[model samples]
Target: MVNVYVLVTSVSPLTSFLHDISVVMTIQHPRGQPVKLRDFLLQHLDPAASHQALRQVKQVISKVLQAAAASTNKKLRTISRCVLCFQLLTFTLLFSSSVTPVVVQVDTQLNVSGLSNDAFDQQITKDLILEDTLHFLLPPLSHLSSHTHLSSEREGSQYGGCTGTLGISLSEDEFLLLLHFQLLMKTSSAFQPLYPSVSSSSSLPRSLSDLPDLLTQIEGFYKLKTNRSCRTDEPPRQQPALSSSQDEGLCVDPHLRQIYTDPPLILTPPFHPLVKEYRTEVTFDTMTVRIRPEPVSSACRIHLDEHRGPRMANYPVGLGNSKISILVMDGSHPEPVIMSIYTVHVYRESRPSLPMFGYHVMCSFVQDCSLLVQPGRPCGLQPHSGSQSQRNACSSGHVSGRWVVPCLSCSDNRTCDWREVSWQPDGCYHPIVDHPLLQDCMKDRKLLFIGDSTNRGMMYFLMERVNSTLEDWGKAHDTLVYRNLNRGRTLVSYSYYPQFWLEKKQRPTFRQALQQLLNRSQPLVNSNQTVLVVGGVQWLNTNHLRTVSEVLDSESLSNILVVVKSLGMGFHLPVDGIRSLSLTEIQDLYRENDDIVTTAKHHGYEVIDTFSITMGRYKEFLQGRCACHFHEVTQLYLSANEALPVVRAAGLTADVLLCFLRWRSFGPQNLPVTERPPQTRTEQRELYIHSAANQPCQTRSRTRGLNPQPIVLEDQ
Candidate 1:
């Protein structure tokens, strides 16, 4: 579906490569190009993805055999060859799949059109998306941090820093660089030879009059640029009130009147530099606009956009819209030049996207870009805390072959490279167990976890987060003493129940655990409020599914809400910078576990996706030192004698998931009556009857049984 264009000769117009065999062309910057496509890509594209592609493209370009040919065709072929090489390189990069391909548009003649409403809106958006943007929620601009929300949980007083929607940006280094470059081209004596003799196109710009033609001539080199014109409501020399944002390498802050090189600006999110919301109050033309309230974090209202994808609530002008703008409104000039200093390109997600709701504000300033521009900038790496023998723990190398760059994540234990690092609420993360409301719900109930040692270890991680007292209550049927007494009455226990494995590993059999789960002999304790988390996929054999099927058949399945945890990532071999396991082996293992996840979901069991949790480079799981990327936690505790670090890393990610786990252990009925919303008499009667109908001690008919297959194990 992608149209391949070709330019056979310098003078030839673009033609489809499929239409003519001789129309092969290389990517070129035409004389009248509007933007610097190459420079923009090189500056904004992720360094990790760019590095991977550049390495591959270099190899391919080096290997392309050369031969004699017509001058025009030879040049065209070279360009075409390199384009092919780069595309192939990016194909590999697509595994990460966040980077988007840039498409450049060029016109031989000056292309101008009357701006339509849509076009005008697009221009306004592109103009206002400056370095210090305000797309997401934020607190008011006061120095007070209390009003500010992290993940959107706080809402308080509001204010106005800017009105009339007249946005001026706090231009960053890259923007300043363009200004500095053009300024130098005009004044620097060293550039005298480059200027053509007295032609209209070559005339020096006394002001902004001669820029368009001059830019057209310069467009043949740098490809990344935008044709932003400077013109707006003017008042000479008034101080502009744009949100202040500071980037690395730039000497001048945008708040002051100065000029310097603009470092490259990256607007991609959730990686874009974090800009806190600024609050202020201003009366514009007797219209005292009331800005919406927010905190460090709050629940963002969800609305279906045109594509039906979930977007934060939209509002009118000067309101709390999910956007921020920074522009330099230089009022000091006689005729103030209003340079629209921003650009935002939103890529539409494909249809049938998974729906998500709720968000909380998180805050952090953009890390100083000096780390990038300044070479060997002294990486203050910290050693991971570890075992007694290695108290210092200063070793740069890891126990396994995984070479994670420590400077990337734990940089001085203060700064990080990513713009906004956080765990999205819906993406395998949740609220904690100690919520004021959840605590009241758990007072009269208990929480039970049934899984292997990995899941048990995850319990330990969760135990740290939710302060609970541990106990060793070894019972006969479920003999493991993996027990915790939280809030005295609420008992949390992990019993080793390796499904389908009857072999003596000195733990209870799966059948014994199931019998205990059903409480066939004893009355079900706190049957209504109790919660069960099941995870035995790692140990399930091919035919072991029958055992699980039988367990699900019991009356306990319908009476209680069950939760399943997906299998953690396994390393079969090294692939895609992760040296832990083979690609095919890991995929095969995940594929097998997918059946477990599928069955659990099919039976209406809530599945906690551990796969996405382990994947690296997501906002919370930053590019480096993540579970999949570098085995971070494993690096802390892994030793040379261990099998490998991948196992430990996988365990650690599961542990992290526990931190994100919500107290969904009890249903709505378990909520303390004081906190529970009131129901009418009729509604309460219906609920009372419903609960009475599903009594646990009662028996059910055996006529309705699932048809599980026979235990055929000959292949083994």
Candidate 2:
């Protein structure tokens, strides 16, 4: 009777005592013909290279027919006729219902692919993979091997009350001798301590300090026995399991949108007796994910970034939803531990050209982080080109525009007003230029300011617009200098780099401080009133713009005017007093800040482009102390609307207040400017926010209200 049809589909009633094993196997077929045990085990078994040893010999014949159906002498013993080898096999079952039905023979003439042509060259000397031999046909039900702790009314009436059928009838050569006795009960390490609760719950502990808490308590005991719920005949009642650090980890790549994970090597079972059986172990080298924030019905104005590469996390077009985690740890263990954890979950979707302004500013001189044209404008409507393939093609031209607030300023009754909302960068009408036409276009300009503290907040915003105040400025990184002697002594200086073009021994590098400020002839004055800005957010390279193209082809430093800033947007929140910054070092600081803004615009310099106006204003930074700076009421209305300079009450800083109205686009048009076009002309261009009494501020409320508090950095 060799018609072996054991069709077990979705079988799990904890293998309902594998329907009392009525053994009857006999097979000889080397042409005795009549074969059809699924067409002779599909012409000699190879379910893509051995279906994990035919599913562990159907789990050792369902634990030897559940030990003879939990025997009271239900009997079945004597299973020892072995010599199998697809790569070493042996067998035995020793059952007991008085040992009579033992007819188990299998001969099908040695090899027609029934393995042993050196089993695929010993499965490539056991490096094995078809997902490492289907990891023993899906083992991780928290490493399954239950020791009959069956109550909850007998495993909920044996997994939802009875569903029958187990008629055993083996033949395709005794199903290849029951897959070589399930690969000798999965590679017998002396039949694994004769099942001491599956050798202590599938053993591993050679102490890597309790292997991540025993692989998180065998993954929360196989997720509490597969989240139990078997209520068909209603006996369901056992819950309590959880703790392995409450176990929420492992969710990996749910259709990825930059939620990475890579330090993984957790293997063990190719016949695991711990250590060399399918071995694997990188333990961990470095992985760190944190994220956190998720309470949203709107207000967390999202902005994540975490990257270490292979896209670990970014989420910028804001709205909300977060939860990162990842961790991993091991640091070659001198006390580093944390072995594994993973959870990802992010979500964004808001868009209509997302800006709802929290804050954004990078303008060291708006030098094209793409699209801002206007200077002899003809690269065919500037399809954004500082070249290197159109520099991020208009990188969201600084949040396209909108955020207004306008008339509202009380003191004692509380509307104190942080210059009440005002960013306008979509198109470009930006008129308002007060403070004596930017202190008469910095009269005889020198403006140096080296790097960090966002280029000394554009030299304390053009020394509070040409000396209306900051006579000294001091946050101590040194070099200071502010001049303005009633506005034309105009000087400015600022040095403080705090290590930008990093070489650092006692400091020097930015090509040795631009060769000591071009061998100082007292403040780089070749004339055409010296304008040397230099930029920040610290790291910059094309060898610092080839030392600002050898100080702009020096004929004794050719009448100065250098610029190059470009790198804004850095909030990176994982919250707890803010200052974070890791989307893998903000993608290696935007590929070397867009390759040093395309080699500082092929060596000519002058490029503020506050990274497309603070790259969608990184959820409006300024949460206090320095969540990457911006609010002195959005840097006094981005320096009174990009350099027309008027608004006053100052405090937080870095959007380079449009690099002081981009130093009136490199000085001397004799101020009073006008522009005016955007009403519906679209290709994008309308940055207008007026009112320091220059009037025009009325688009109220697209929602704003953040108050986290801590920004006092003052010294500019």
- Model 2 lDDT vs. the true structure? 0.36
C-alpha lDDT of all candidate models, in order: 0.29, 0.36
lDDT against true structure, model 1? 0.29
Number of colliding residue pairs in each model? 55, 34
- All candidates' TM-scores? 0.29, 0.27
| Candidate 2 structure quality by residue, lDDT tens digits, 447-556 | 66676666665566457545654444435465655554444556766665545234556666666665554444264666546767677653556777786767557647
Model 1 Cα lDDT, one tens digit per residue, 542-648: 34334545665664445555556665443321212223444445556656666766666566555655543333221121012112221111111223453211111
Tell me the lDDT of model 1 at 209. 26
List candidate 2 segments past 4 Å from native. Answer: 1-177, 180-350, 354-402, 405-449, 452-496, 500-506, 509-515, 518-523, 526-528, 531-571, 574-616, 620-716
Error of 2 at 220 (Å): 34
Number of the top-ranking candidate, with lDDT as the measure: 2
TM-score of predicted structure 1: 0.29
